[model samples]
Target chain A: MAPILEARHLSKRFRIPSVKRSTVREHVLGMLRPSSTEELVVLDDVSFSVERGETLGIMGRNGCGKSTLLKILSGIYMPDTGEVIARGPITPILELGVGWNPELDAIDNILLLGSVMGMSLKELRQATDEILAFAELERFANMKLQHYSSGMASRLAYAVAFRAVREILILDEIFAVGDAGFRERCESRFRELHSSGHTAIVVSHDPRTIKTFCDRALLVDRGHVVVQGDGLTVADAYTALLTHEPAAAAPTAALPEAVPAS
Target chain B: MADAPTRRHHWGGLVWTLVRTDFKARYHGTVGGFVWALLKPFTMFLVLLGVFSFIFASDPVYKRNLLLGLFLWDFFAEGTKVGIISMHQKGYLLTKTRFPSWIVVVTSASNAVITLAVFTVAIVGFLALTGRTPSPVELVLYLAYLVAALLIVAGISLAGSVLFLRYRDLNQVWDVVTQAGFFVAPIIYPLNILPERFHFYLYLWPPTAIIQFSRAVLVQHDIPTLRAHLMLLGMTAVVFTAGAAIYRRFAPRAVEYI
Candidate 1:
């Protein structure tokens, strides 16, 4: 089957200025000096494809460009090179409750953040009670978000994302934020979607999550895919990479292409 | 499914909900709530009205003109100023969601539209209190000019927001420009008080045409000349187009820079 999403040769580089110029005068003053900038290549020649109904787990260490790859796939940051072709609606849970107004009540946030997530107004209206009930914040539905605890905010955000789930979900370490109970519930929801054939690209540092939830997984180190195989194998590869052991160096050096999925 | 494109088309409801949230956010924690939106322009109206009225107590026409001009000026000034920084102010939304960037500009400006509506009612109330009936046709023309004024400001805001994303100094520069505009556009004084050579300059400024055209139709009860109407149309087109072009050019990479 043809893949539902394709990211071809994606690359991104961020230019960091060595000098800091906060004001117009400082900027002008620095113009007379030699200019220097360092380019941080976050992603380099990264290519991946996800078949319809497939959950592709993305595993990497910190600063390994996993999040950058997700951002590029979601169109938040246009890649420096290459392109992303998505066949269906792309829902990016890059950050939950991103546009939530702290000054507004929970109900208001449900409307604003829901619509911002591309759920139609009618859908949000219908899902309001469900979201409030799911988040277990129905009692505080009218209270401003500022008064809610951080955990409550994440719960509310997760509730909203749960309702706004689309054809293709791009999740970036979402499991890292919520509590244990919420994480369990999220895992179950992921299982439900997994069984129901929803395509997703999940970025996680947790090996168990990648191994259990994904059908196939890719291990990225230094912005390059080093291993691609069944979830267990890739998770083991990621674990080995984390232990400062070069367990997959021979395979990585031998084949630049992703290890074909079993 | 094929319904993906339709999902992107649903920004209208999103923009409206966002505008509503911002409208509430703007007034949150403040006493008198949205009344503040009217208070700034109305207070300016009162101060200028009191000082100018004492000087020209005999000429009620100038006071009324000033009252109306101040309303239009406040709409233009407040709308563009808020609109310019709106995109950056909502960085949370920009960085996190796949929302269209222009909606940020529109949502910011919509706040001013609400404030403008409040002042619009105030203007009508003043006309009634003074017992001077504006022509019905001219009242409609006044509404049209108000929309034109919004488009002109919205255009400037689009360009200004993008410019500000790159240059933080624009806020200071915008302050100076609006201050210069307040004095130059004949908000407190009548347009005729200025000499002919200055009239050419006024013609070049879009807000001047908006204010002068509004005064001619609403206050003076006379239709603007055809050339004057075309000039307003031309200026709105030029500013809006220029602003849209600038915004489009910068929008793709705006997230990185901002």
Candidate 2:
């Protein structure tokens, strides 16, 4: 079967104005002088594909455009010169409880965020109890989220998002939060989804996670794909790249092209 | 493709949730709660009625007309004002997910619609107390005008919200426009009070046509001409289309600025 998701020659560039003018008065004064902009290429001709049910891990250092790549794939940000073809709905857990209203209780927030994630009202309503149970916040389900601890809120967000996951899930730092026990539950749940043939593209800095959880992985450095291979190989490359001097030449030509899934 | 219905269902559910949550969050922890929604236009109506009654003492239906005018004007003013800032208020949602951007503006403006619905009940009570209930035909005509007013607000808001991301001072500019609009739209006094020649100019503003025609049908028991109806429809179409066009041009880049 063809890949469930394909990104072809994706490139994104952002222009940063030398002087930010966000007011009408400042804009009026800005016309007197020609403003200059510095262009930043966040992603450069990056190409990749994910087969159905496969987990693709993206390993990168800070500011290497990992999050930007995920955002583009999830349709949160449009690529400047390329396209993303998704065969099915994409549930992007870029941030948990994105539309959550702190004034609302857990049930209301589940309804809000779940719908925002493309779940129907009936599905969300039926799954509300299950979500609350998963988060272990059944007792606090009626309480306002603002009054809850940050960890509790994070749990609720994860519970709600997991319930609302659709065809393809794009997760950013899914294991970055929660206690060890809660992280264990998340990992098991993720494994269950993976076994059930839910395609996912997970971005993380931890090589161990990529090695253990991902079937295939890509190492990215400064807007270029450094290498793509089986999980362990790419993870080792990421670790080795970290120790090398920043000024050392990147092994861009030596790496093989990202093989599109057949 | 088979899940198309599910996608529609989700968007509908999302819009409803956002609107409902907005209504609750605005009134949460308040002493008056939802009552404040009613009190705002009613209080303004009372103040305006008191002052305007002295000026138009000769007209018998002045009270009803003034109340209706205020309610309609309040909806427009409140809707656009809230709608303009809605994108920024919901910036977190836009940046974190992929959904229709227009939902943010519509949900923010919908609070005004709910307030107007509640105000409609109050209007009926006031009309009954004054022994001047509108005919069914008049109510229908008035409803059509209310829809037109809403479209005008939606149009302005659609453009305003996107523009607001770049021009942070847009709300202040809108405040000035609405402040001037309050008097220019014939909210406190009837349009006839102005010269007949200037009436055409006043009608050029969409709200002016909406408020005046609404008052003409519901309070004055007068049916507007077919030409006037067409004019209102044309103006609404133009405003809404222009706003949608501007939004389409700019909204794609809105997330960057936000």
Candidate 3:
């Protein structure tokens, strides 16, 4: 099957400014030129592809470029060297409720949020009752979102995201939101959605989520993908990188052949 | 929300949504709130008319045209003032989402328009009460001038929003400009009273044409010539396009700066 999403030689860089609050005026005036701060490559030359109807997971330590990679894939940030070519609708939950207007009611936010995620207000109205009910916010739909608790925002955001007719979903650490019960509901929903042939790119350090749910996994470190293969091998290598430092990572053993051969 | 409706539809929907929210939140929680839009401009008109009418009664030009000119100037002043603060006030919306960002300026201008709408009704009523009923030609001229005033204020608002975004210091500069525009735009005094050399500046001012056209229609009951109409339209077009280009180039960066 043709890939639903592809990233070729993707890279991103950030320039840190040399100036600091402690820099004295005399020192600043002493030099005709401002110093160049170090350039940090947040996402190095990394490439990956997501085939249609596939579940892929990325496991890494903090600042492993997982979010950056997802951003490039979602077109939020253009890659420095390459492109993220996708074939279908992509919904990225990089930060849930990123566009919520506090003064507006949740219903209004639902309309705006749905639009940002590529749904029209007409389509949003169709899913309105389901979204509110899933978030357990039927009564509070008319209230301003500023009044919502953290968990409430998480629930509503998750409900709205999963409710869309998204061909590809990129989740960035948003699954950890809400309580254990909500997490279980989300996991079951993932199972149901996956069975319907939906594609998902989930970024998590959780071994259980990777080994159990992901058909394939990639281990990323310092903006580079070190290993890409079966769930068990990638997850074990990721765990090793965490427990031991990145320098101590042993060569990953072959994963079981029972998994889909990516 | 409907996936980029027709150009006319898309722009119109965006303007309406923003304008509605702008109108709502601005006066939210106050008693008899929206009425304040009408009351405020009306009060300014009465006060200024009283003060200026007494001071400049001997001058026929001032007595004839000052009210309409002052009314239009008030709209531009209030519109541009709010336009400067619009993106900052709605920082949450701008920082995260990208939709017709120009609507911020449009919404502020619309607020001014809404307030000015009431002033318009009062203008008609004032004329009737004073037995200065306008001819059909003059009535049509009022429409032309209304369109001109709206266009000028809206265009300046678009440019002002962009400048405020690029250079934050311009917020103070605009406050001074509105004050300056009020005195310099010939609101209190007619251009005839100013020396001929200075009168040239008035013709060059885009808003001055709007003010002059409005005064001619509302006070003198005369329609603008085809040349004057075309000039106002051309100026409106240039400012609107320039403002849009400036906004399109920098509005995305507004996310980082804002």
User: Clashing pairs in model 3?
Assistant: none
Error of 2 at B243 (Å): 1.2
On the 0 to 100 scale, the lDDT of residue A24 in model 2 is 83
Output DockQ, candidate 3.
Answer: 0.17
Instruction: Write candidate 3's Cα lDDT for A191-229 as tens digits.
Output: 888999999999887888888888998988777888899
- In candidate 2, what are the lDDT values of residues A180-250, reduced to their tens digit? 98898889999998999898898888888898899999988878887899999888888888888453246
What does candidate 1 score on TM?
0.92
lDDT of 2 by residue, B88-109 (tens): 9888778766778998887898
In candidate 2 chain A, where is summed lDDT lowest over 10 consecutive residues? Answer: A253-262
Better of 2 and 3 by lDDT: 2
Better of 1 and 3 by TM-score: 1
- Candidate 3 segments exceeding 4 Å error: A19-38, A245-262, B1-16, B29-31, B59-67, B82-100, B103-108, B125-166, B252-258
For the record, the alpha-carbon RMSD of candidate 3 to the native fold, in angstroms, is 7.1
DockQ each candidate and list the results. Answer: 0.46, 0.49, 0.17
* Interface quality of candidate 2 as DockQ: 0.49
DockQ order of candidates, top first: 2, 1, 3
> Fraction of native Cα contacts kept in each candidate?
0.48, 0.50, 0.07
